[model samples]
Target: MTAQVKYDDVEVGTEIPAQTYQIDRMNLVMYAGASGDFNPIHWRENFARKVGLPDVIAHGMYTMAQGGRFVTDWVGDPGAVLDYGVRFSAPVVVPDEGGAALEISGKVEQKLDDNRVVVALTARSSEQKVLTRAKAVVRLA
Candidate 1:
């Protein structure tokens, strides 16, 4: 689908609506199955703790995908995204009880040529920054 947002209407510093995604053990298991990243640290608390982690943690790529979802949902087209990248900073610790909450937000950082804009994103979980240097380049309609 084509992007719903127009390049002419966008400005640097325009805010993308924030989104919060719930990540639980079941979700991690499903992600592991789908991604083939069953490294145990993502699904087994014992293994995670044995490896020096506080608890079972969400996959880094899963967290990055949430950031991607935030950008695409705002720009209104997944294909509009030309480039996306992030550095994993902290883990999203999932306890046995309630799921963890991953909060994602972004803003247009630069308006580039060719209807493209650079977006700076922030991802946080459990009051700790989870992803650093998260950014996406998107082409608007």
Candidate 2:
């Protein structure tokens, strides 16, 4: 855990520190089991190829969760998040060997009433394609 972010200390254009998340086949498998989303496109390479995917792709929700992690870690408490949403803009291609790395970043876009802030987030893979277009509303102390 980290220190709570005081509401008065943040500005609309302030950028939150970025973080990287590594995703591999094992991670996808584990997420599939945990989330009960056993879509073969997320695991079986042959199915992915048959479906015209470049390779076994990471689950969209998994990538979104990683982006959520970045924000939750920054805000110090998951309970501080009031609302969060994202659109899966691109598929995260998970290679068999090197896997894929996601770099996620956030910025305060607006300050609402009652010490709330709207955060805009961007998540990209190594190929520079945006994977998740996310935004969240957080309540600050």
Query: Which 10-residue span in candidate 1 carries the lowest summed lDDT?
Result: 1-10
Residue-by-residue lDDT tens digits, candidate 1, 15-75: 9878899999999999999999999999888999999999999999999999988888888
Put down candidate 2 lDDT per residue, 68-131, tens digits, no spaces.
Answer: 7887899898999999999888899998999999999899999999999999998999766565
In model 1, pairs of residues that clash are: none
TM-score of 1: 0.96
Worst 10 residues of 2 by lDDT: 125-134
What TM-score, computed on C-alpha atoms, does each candidate reach? 0.96, 0.96
